[model samples]
Structure formats: structure tokens, C-alpha cells
Target: MGHPLLRRRLLLSLPLAAATAGGLGFYILLERARQGTYNPQTFSNPLVGHRVPDFRLVGIDGKHGFGSSQLIASKKPILLNFFASWCVPCAGEAPYLDVISKSGVDIWGIAYQDKAKALAFYLAKYGDPYTRLATDPTGRTAINFGVYGVPESFLIAPGGIVRWHIAGPLVPPIINEQLRPELQKIA
Candidate 1:
């Protein structure tokens, strides 16, 4: 019923439309992949060269309270770790942190979004590496630190300046390679 030239043009246009649809779908998939890689779970703050936030919190020891001021008063560099018992990455870093603590780096830990009982159990199981353990019952302390999740560590100098911030898990190589050198400089 249609002219031969018109029929040929229609067939050509159909292939073009299909190619455009396929291209669009591929582009969307690529964009999704990029977004997935930028997930918050993989993100860490750039706290280096910034002053550490100071705040008072109830210590896990239940006998004494603690704040950033106490760490600054020590006149020695400090490592402040934010963790939670429920966080798998936090658990993974605990043993390595215990090793680091023995080096006299003045490590302090803040329990974020955790129950007191769970915190006690975690410390008991993993061995408390922190010289002072603070509990953030309502997660307010973590919010102040600009924390979106657990297993973050901040390196603070004697003057209370945050020298480094590591988000997510702290692997042994990271401690040995990245953290150790920075600590040596501060020490």
C-alpha cells in the first residue's frame, strides 16, 4: 500500500529509534554504577588540617567523665575513634587498635548509636583498646563530629587539631602505611 521509498525510510527510522533506546539504557546503567561507587558507606570525611570538635560525654567506665579538653591537656597526640558494637567494620579494626593503643598514642573511643549493655559486651569481647571510652547514647556526639556512620577515626595533635580522618574500616596496611607515618610526625 505504501511507496517503496517510503517503506525503506520507515524501516531505517525504526532501527534508529531502537539504537537510541539502547544507548539511553546503557547510559542509565553506567550512571547507576557510578552512583553505587559513591555510596556513603565508602565515604570518609576530610578532617585533616581541621580543629577537633570538643564535647563532654559520659564515659563507658561509669566512674569518670571525659571530653576533648582532657586529651588536649595531655599535651600529646591522640587518636579518637568513633565506633559501634553493631558495626562489623568497627569489630574488624578493634584488635589492630589494641596493638596501636599499646604504643602510648592516647587513644579514646566514642560509642555511637549503641546501647550501654552492648557496649560493655563489645569491650569485654574485643579487649578495650581505648584509654577512655565515651558513650553517645543518643548519637548527639557523633552528629557533632559530622559522623554519618561508625568505624571512623580521627587523629588529633597535641594542640587538638584533627590531622587525619579515616572513614569505614581501618585495615592493617592503612595503619602500618598511612596512620603510622602521620603518628610518627606528631610524636
Candidate 2:
């Protein structure tokens, strides 16, 4: 038989155990609700305000590649877009990116781990907005920029400094309100 003191202690701990369990359950429920309510798709990149390493980019031609100097020598700011043919959001943002390019913004497209043929098809369907295009077949460039997903854009200054980074689709409002002002400054 258990001692009376031990029995009493066990009974006293029951309420504390129940309270702890209830608190943990509540936390889990709140977390689930929070995640469900938010997009949860975007990631904040830590590379903002830093200079990206210079690398060669093949100018939409798989055979011939160009160095980073060509892009850096430009006076205007460059929009470096990382996208994949398989990403649905990339399709959604394609038109906006085209519009940005047409507005005299230099957009450099990096095909993130995508096949060149599929990339051509996607560009043909969505409209090619890139001033210069390249492919990152191994996603090494994406990893360097801390890209966890597709449809990420980095606004790079002429000196190769990464000024701003956006993680999702480049919608019209974002273009008009946020990007335009910053671009004006750089211009």
C-alpha cells in the first residue's frame, strides 16, 4: 500500500498537471490559428543592405555567358528576379514584371533550378520582361541570396548592393507605391 503522505501529494499534483496540459493545448491551438490566418509563404531575407557576390550570367543564351560587370556598369538600378517555371505565383507576377521592365527598369531574370525549354515556354506565355536572363540550374545563386521560394525580387543598386528584397508576387500596388518611390530615388 502507498504511504498516506505520498497519496496526498499525488492528489495535490493532479490540478497542477491538468493546468499545465491545458496551457500547452491552448498554445498549440493559438499557433495553428495564427498560421492559418496568415500567408506564411514569405520569408524575410537577411541580405538586405549588403553587396551580393558578383557572378557570370549567360544572356538568355545557354552557350554564351556574361560577367557581372555588364550589369554593374549601368547607371540605373537593377531588379533581380528569381523565378521558376513551375511556380504559379511567378506566372501571376510576370505581367507586372514586364510592365516594370517596359517602364525602363532593368530586370535581370534568374531561372531558379528550371529547365531552359520550360523557361522559354513560360516566358512566351507570360511575356518576357527581363532585360537580361540567366539560368541557375543548381539553385546556387538562389541559395546565395537566401531564397527559400520562388517569385523573389531584389532591388540592386548600380554598385551591386542589394537595396530591397520582396518575397512574393510583384503586384501593381507594390509596384506603384513601394517600388516606384525607391526607384525614383535611385534614378
Candidate 3:
């Protein structure tokens, strides 16, 4: 048997270990809160009201795809979305995106930080609503668009100007009320 003092010390250490664990959990929660709340005015590229960045990426069909110039050439408004299979918000917004695409808008999708197979699985399951799907293997295209996370969307005018940007998951109301009107104004 252990000494009585040693037994008491071991018993007391249980509460200390729990307290340490609790403290660590609380600290992690606080850090997450801070990160979530830290929204900056300027995105990486500050694309709003600026010309859309030129990029060429791989399409879902494994073809070389391009943005910006193609939209300008087509003389139509463009909706660009940054998404990834692993992003929950992106999945949440998928149905709304499908609706928008079906409405005849020139919608394009950029798969950010995602593998082709995963992107294919997501599209297969959720239905591909994009007129074109550009794969950004390294997420460099997302950085150009000032994207902090997946499910970020941009409305570009016929002149290739980025008119509006929405972060996070999108809903039908947001699309109809805010995004559609903004696109009309730019168009």
C-alpha cells in the first residue's frame, strides 16, 4: 500500500487535472470566439467595385477554364462563388446556388482548397448549378477574390466589375432581395 500522504496527494491531483483541462477548454473557446468575430473591412484583393481578377483553372470536366475575360466577352453579368466540399456553409448554400443558376444567371464556381474527386462527389450529390466549375487546387484564386472562407459569392457586372460580395451561406431571400437588386443596378 502507498503512504497515506501520497494517497491524499493523488486524490487531490484529480481536481487539479480537471481544472487544468477546463481552463484549456475555456481558452480554446475564447480563441475561437475571437477568430469568428474578427471581420476586416478589406478582403485580400479588395475586389468590390474593382475589375475581376483574371484566372485560368481546371474545370470539373478536366478542361482549362478561364474567368473575367470570358464574362466580358459574353457581355453578361457573372456570379462567382468560392466553395469547397469540406465547408459546411458551402453545402448549405448549394441549393440556393442551384436555384440562382436555373434562373439563367451566368454563374461560375471556383472550388477552393479542394481535391477534384471530392468536388465531383459534392456536385454529384448536391447537383451542379454552375455554368462552369473552376478548380483552384492551391486556393490562389480564392485569395485573389479576397475570400476568407468557402461559400463566399460575388456579383460581377457585364463590364467585368465586381459589384457585390456576400460571405458565408446564402439563402433565397438574400439572393432575391439584395443580390438580384445589386446585379440589376450594375447591369
TM-scores, one per candidate: 0.74, 0.74, 0.73
lDDT of 3 at 182: 91
Candidate lDDT scores, in order, read: 0.80, 0.80, 0.79
What's the TM for model 3?
A: 0.73
| lDDT tens readout by residue for model 3, 1-187 | 7899999999999999999999998888777445442234435347788888887787766676766678666678888888889989888888888888888887888888888788889989988888877888898878777887788888888778888887766676578767889977865
Error of 2 at 12 (Å): 33
Q: Global lDDT for candidate 1? A: 0.80
Question: Which regions of candidate 2 fall more than 4 Å away from where they truly are?
Answer: 1-43, 59-67
lDDT (10s digit) by residue, model 1, range 35-72: 43223345556556877677888876575657868866
Candidate 3's displacement at residue 2, Å, is: 84
